[model samples]
Target: MTARRSTFTALVTLLTFAGILVAPQASAASLVEVTAFGDNPGGMRMHVYVPDSRPASPAMVVAMHGCGGSGPGFYSGSEFASLADRHGFIVIYPSAQQEAGFGKCFDTWSDAAKRRGGGSDPVSIVSMVTYAQQRYGGDPGRVFATGSSSGGMMTNEMLALYPDVFKAGAAFMGVPFGCFANAADYPPGASRCTGNGGANRTPQQWGDLVRQAYPGYTGTRPRMQLWHGTADTLVPYSLLREEIEQWTDVFGLSQTPTSTDTPRAGWNRSRYGDEVEAYSIQGAGHSLPSSGMAAAALEFFGITGTPDPDPPVPGTCSVKPTVNAWNNGLTASLAITNNGTATINMWSLAFTLASGQTITSGWNATYAPSTGQVTARNAGYNGTIPPGRSVDIGFQATHTGNAAAPSSFVLNSTACSTG
Candidate 1:
């Protein structure tokens, strides 16, 4: 055991310095291998990492791997085990059976896997968690789960089918639970599986699917964080919108975002109260962000704050608004510029609409219209504005007679000069 620990530490140090390890792969000598079977059908193999100085009941995180990826690959790629070392938690990387189908992916699209009871993939995962808690002294209350791609789809299944087992979950580049009911529904391309688009379903209808997955359990729903790359060709970006709607409906939260911010370049987060949040990674495609996500998910789970040490402060930046193109009194193209030295994490622009005019639809921001008052908050992708950088947000409106632009605008509570 001592020699294995020494070798693991050396491998990690080399990988960190080389900056080449990111993503899940087959097990390494460092991870402790264990098979979970006998009780659960279609059993799984788990590669677990325990920190050196764990508490009596340390937090446990179960991470699932994407198609063609191994538990160790995910463990090394996400550096989740490294996080466990720092945070004193246990990290489990569970592998799907190769017979499960394409690239050894979890059987998330099959009805058998979606069921809550025994013989299903979801229940098999629960069994693994139970083993961790019983054998390794894991805290039952602080269990969390996360995954990417097909594994992410499985993560969705776990959250919906076993909400009582997981306090929170995060899925990257994956669809909502029950998105695809069968293999035939999967897209032909490299894109991940997505079903129905949920376009025809009401919020209540979508929430009903989740409730039916568990059947008669009325415990607190698990919190969720969703991440997707906007430029991914495989999975449509619109799927992220559908997923947000599904979980928010389950939590009974409004569609409108409670807060929006760009924590870094290419990463925009829209938070819905505290129950659900979504991150849109700008210009990224089909993979997890190369850095920071593991720690970020842990921070979301209340495990540690190593990722975001400094909490966000309200911006004091100056905003300048410009009217790019105004349609025949009905539509307008507008742009806002950040003119402050510091990057603005979140921004909101407010202006009173002209009498008898109302906003209909908007882009690059969320528009909330009231009687003579209109507020637009940054959308997921445009929330972070670096110094001197600008983003465009536009809206279409209906007017009875003459259409006129609002005289002034306020951004983040500071008055903005109309350009």
Candidate 2:
């Protein structure tokens, strides 16, 4: 009898601990309807994932849906729930207004949406965020968004129209076609998706409009990521490429890169200044492939990435920056500047060298010649750099027999040219 009672007590104790271990940390899971207040919210329905711990964690993100889709569809298909589970972050999926017409897109770039009186989607988005913070536990400081197709276009529009509302945004296969074009050509000119009383404008027109708006805009441009398939039939590749070029040019980015096919079968990758980047897949089209784009984008959004199996810190790198040389290699000095407000723990730059010449030696960093890469380690020994500080790391190398010194280089993941 004594033995049985002891065994039962032990079993009960173990079970209780196990239950505690498995319990979720969030306070409550709430599904709230964000009323458009009779303003026609584009039929947007909102659902939130709030944790048990209130105010302790950041309510990380809210993702909007594309044309003809709802919040549930985006949440279930995008695998955002799993990300929420892993990161202990809250995610809200919000729907857009739907109309009983041939086209089902939000008039993202419309001038009406820009004004206070118009049934603006940006206002609705801001309202949703405000509601989440007030009623639900949302950390306004860390809010971000990622959208697809029409949702992506809205993401771009929101960045331009409501730049202060979000810290960051990712556009997957979406571009603000009409907003960037000439207002006059757009019919009801500049009224959102349907221009001039609901007429649609072409990509060229959209680009022209954006150019005109660029000079006088006073708001800061938030961080953004643009992902599109090279072969996307739904949104032509040409339009996306033009937008990419236009944005980089507008930003005054100096670096220009030639595309090279990545080892990943159909992938082609190119880099401009640290400000602009693009990836194109030769045979891939329309949608995201299973592999790297999302992960890459997540990194771009400042989200923590998969811990490097072996953190790349504590490594030394080499570079032989130079000018003109018959060997297709020249001696030059490379300077790395920290643009962000915080100190970077570590950073790496990867690029291919001209077929023959190679990097010989780099300072305060290490060089991996075989991979054509450079990695720097400043942990512990190197202190934090004050905001807007610059660090100079140079390299020394001799051009191999009869090879021309390499003229261009990539820094901190951005391409750089001599000119």
Candidate 3:
């Protein structure tokens, strides 16, 4: 047997000896199995946990398992369910169908699983998200995915394939999206992408892979949290860099991190403008996130001990947009008027820019995320507006071809008329 397999076995045995291992079937006691959740194209099973306390629109998390693991098994081994009980959110544990006795593994290597609406594990997982939304009034805007090893790979896949669904994800010991391509020989299969393959792609090359996963996708990409061990042998330790490169490029961040610090002793973290964050556990092994990870992941997902932001009420504002267009770019202006009864101390205008359209610079307000669902917050000079008064903010955005106007104007949680 290869040393990696031997080490994997030894780690599993050690976790089992430490009472961290639980049988897949035994997890059913805590998580209710949901068969016929969808067409089951991936042949995966679904299990869910609903806390007694729930918000009117509680958030939902899809907690996936690694190879040789089942949904309930992960549900038991992971802290998400207990966190759900405390936080009033729901958790879904998905169990992949055992493949050729190789162990139950989510399909991150298959073409069917890589693309959008391709009808495989990914489609099945989306169906589960839809099921949760329809059945439990789950907040569509707050869905998230997380996993370890194989499941971690799927977390990257989920964000890439369905950014419209997931706001963010935390992937543990995961490789870059499409890292398994051309390498079906993993874990006994001789592959170049894992275990000393030496992650050779440039950041743009890796970003192209993620963009290709869902062609023509122009939405604001979901954020990512990456965790990996420095001493991993099953998956190459260098993959953490590849994953970082891929996602930072997607979020339009430079390779250099905005901040670097140690969250805890022995755990080094680098954050790329909050769009991508990588945590390196020094001297750790395969399958990272030893403990106290779920809470941190939840924090990244904005699910603090409290619930999600309350749904906004009917808007009492107006947005007037004017644009000066060129062949490759445009300068757009917005007039935000306050129609509320009281004076506004602070204001933020939220809108969605077309795909490929990125804000290069702006005046009168601060723009964030350049593209996708963007927030233009008032600068210090324009933070206050009296009733019946208007604030003018303009930004210059670059676009390759599509120069359509931004839409879905929301000012401080109030819907605004885009007149």
Candidate with top lDDT is 3
Full-model lDDT, candidate 2:
0.52
Report every candidate's CA lDDT. Answer: 0.73, 0.52, 0.80
Provide the RMSD of all predictions against the true structure, rounded to 1 decimal: 11.4, 16.2, 21.0
Write the residue-wise lDDT of candidate 2 on 197-278 in tens digits. Answer: 2324443454445445434565655566566765455565554565465445545554365333353434465666554456
The clash numbers for all candidates, in the given order, read: 8, 50, 2
Residue lDDT tens for model 3, 203-283: 999899889988998888899999997767778778899999999988889999999987654579899997899998765
- TM-score, cand. 3 vs. native: 0.65
lDDT of 1 at 403: 76
Can you write out model 1's per-residue Cα lDDT over 1-419, one digit (the tens) per residue?
Answer: 99998998898889879986533322423577665422566567777887776799999999988887788777766657766867789888888874544567777767777778746567677887887888778999999999988777787888998899999998888787877757656543523344234334566766888988988998999999999987665566777887788899999999999999987644799999999999997655565633567678888999986465233323443434333334444666666777767655445566777787777776777665433766666653465667777788877777766577665687745667676
Ranking by lDDT: 3, 1, 2
Candidate 2 C-alpha RMSD relative to the actual structure: 16.2
Question: Which pairs clash in the backbone of model 1?
Answer: 22-77, 23-73, 23-77, 24-73, 24-74, 25-72, 25-73, 25-74
